[model samples]
Target: MPAKIVVIANQKGGCGKTTIAMQVGGTLGRAGNRVLIVDADPQGTATRWAASAADESSFPAHVAGLAAAGGKVHREIKKYLDSYDYILVDCPPAVDSPVPQSALLIADVALVPIIPSPADLWAATGTRGLIERAGDINTALQARMVVNMLQSNTSMSKEVLEVLEDFGIPLTLAKLHLRTAYRQAAVFGGTVHDLGREAAKAVQEVEALAHEILSLFKNN
Candidate 1:
C-alpha cells in the first residue's frame, strides 16, 4: 500500500510543528511502521534534529531534507510512497510558502499544531485557508488541528480549546502539553520514548497522537 502522506503545518512560528512531526513520526516508527520524514521548511528544523542524533538508530524515522520543492514536491514524494507506511512533511511556518501548499497537494491529512494563544488561533485561520485552497486541487486532503504546548489547569488553555471548537476545524482529542521532556529529548537527539521515567507523560502523549492519526487514516 502507498504511504499515507501527512503534512504537519501551521502559518505561525513557535507552534511546535517540527516537534510534533518528529514525535509523531518517531512514535509510528517505534510502533513498527515504515516512516519517512520530509523536511520541507527552508529553516531545516527537522533536518537539524535528525542531524543532532547521536547515532542513526537514535531517531526512529528516516529523514531527508527537501527544502521548498514547490509544486513538484507532490509528484516528487510519490517515488517514496511505495517504500514507506507513512510520510510526514514538516512544512514551513508561512502559509504562503510553496512547500506547505505542495505538501497539501498530496497529503492524506494535514495536521495543524496550534499553541494555546489568540495569535496562534488567528494563525490557524490562515492555515485553514491554505488547506481549503489545496483541497480544491487535492480532494483527498483532510485537515485536523492538534493543540500543542498546552498548559494544564490554565484558563488560557481552556479558552483556546473553546475558541477552536467553534473554528469549524476538526480538533483531535490527543493534545500535547508544555513540558521540558520535549526540549530535553530534542537536545539529546531522541524522542520522549528514549527519555527515562521523567518523560513518561510526554511519551504517552506522543503515543496517543500516533494512535489517533492512524485511526484517522484507517477511517478515511
Candidate 2:
C-alpha cells in the first residue's frame, strides 16, 4: 500500500505545526514504520530539526525539503508514495501560501494545530475554510484540529476549549500542553522520547496523538 499522507497546517504562526509534524512522524518511525517528513515550509524548520541530530542517533524519520515545489508539492510528493509508511508535510503559516492547498489535495488527513487563544481561534477560521474547500476537491480528505500549548488551568484556556467544541473542525482528544520538553526535543533534534524521564508527560501526549491518528486510518 502507498504511504498515508498527513499535512500539518495552520493559518497562524507559533501554533506548533512543525513540532506536531516532527513528534508524530518520529513516533511512528520509532515504532519501526518507515516515515518521511516533507519539509514544505520555506523556513525549513523540520529540515533543521533533523540536521540537529547527532551522527550516532539521527532523527528516526527522513527529512526532505520540498518548499521549492510550492503549488506543485502534491505532484512532487507522489514520487515517494510507495517508499514509506507515512509522509507528513509541514506547511508554512502563511495564509496566502499554495503549499497547504497543494498538500491537502493529496493528503489522507490534515492536522491543523491551534494554540488556545482568541487570536488563534480567529485565525483558524481561515484554515477551516481552506480545509472545507480542499474537501470539495479531495473527497477523501479528513481534517482535525489539534489543540497545542494548552494550559488547562487557565480560565482563558478553558474558554477557548469551550468555544472550540463548536468550532467546525473536530478536535483531537489528545492535546499538547505548554511544556519545556517540547522545546527541548527540537533543540536535541528528536521527539519527546529522546528527552528521557524529563519528558514523560510529553511522551504520553505525543504517543496518544500518534495512536489516535493511526486509528483513523485503521477505521477507514
Candidate 3:
C-alpha cells in the first residue's frame, strides 16, 4: 500500500505549521510506522528542525527537503509512496505558492493549523479553498482546521472555538496549547516523547493529534 499523504499547510506564517508537522510526524513514527516528512517550504524550517536533532536515530522519522518542486512536487512525492506508511508535507505559507497546491493534489488529508485570531480565521478560507479545489481532482481529500497555540483556561480560547465553527471546514477535536515543551524540543531536537515523564501532558497532546489523524485513514 502507498503512504497516506498528510499535508500540513496554512498560508499564514507563525501558525505553527512546522511544529505540528514535526510533532505529529514524530508521534506517528514512534508508533512503528515508516513515516517520512517532506519539507516543501522554501524557508526550510522543517528541514532545519530535523537537522538540529542531537541523535538522528532518535528523531523518529526520515526528513527530506524539496524546497522548489512547485507543481511537480506531486510527481516527485510518488517516488516515496511505497517506501513509507505515512508522508507528511510541510508547505510554504502562501496560497500563491505552487508547492502547497501540488501537495494537495496528492494528499489524503490537509491539516491547516491556525492560531486563534481574526487574521488566522481569514487566512484559513484560502487554505480551505485550495483543499476543496484539490478534492475536485483527488476526490478523497479531507481538509481539517487545527487550533494551535491555544491558551489554557481563558475565555479567549473558548471564544476562538466558537468562532472557528463559522468556518466551513471540519475542526480537529485534538488541539495544541501554547507550551514551552514544543519550543524546547525544537531547539534541541527530538519530540515530547523524548522528553520523558516530566513532559507527559505535552506528550499526550501530540499523541492525541496523531491518533486523530490515523483514525482518518482507518475510516477510509
TM-score of each: 0.96, 0.98, 0.96
User: Which residues of candidate 2, in runs, are more than 4 Å off?
Assistant: none
State the C-alpha lDDT per candidate. 0.88, 0.94, 0.89
Scanning candidate 3 in windows of ten residues, the lowest lDDT window is 117-126
Give lDDT tens digits, candidate 2, residues 9-87: 9989889999999999999999999999999999999999999987625789999999999999999999999999999
Q: Write the per-residue lDDT of candidate 1 for residues 1-220, one digit (tens) a residue.
A: 9999999988898788899999999889888899999988889888888778898677889998888566678777988999999999988886567788888888999999988899888868888888899999998788899998999799988988898998877999999999999998888777898888999999988888889998888776
Q: Which number leads on lDDT? A: 2
Error of 2 at 81 (Å): 0.3
List of clashing residue pairs for candidate 1: none
Model 2 whole-model lDDT (C-alpha atoms): 0.94
Best by TM-score: 2
Candidate 1 local lDDT, residue 130: 88
Q: How accurate locally is residue 153 in candidate 1, as Cα lDDT from 0 to 100?
A: 93
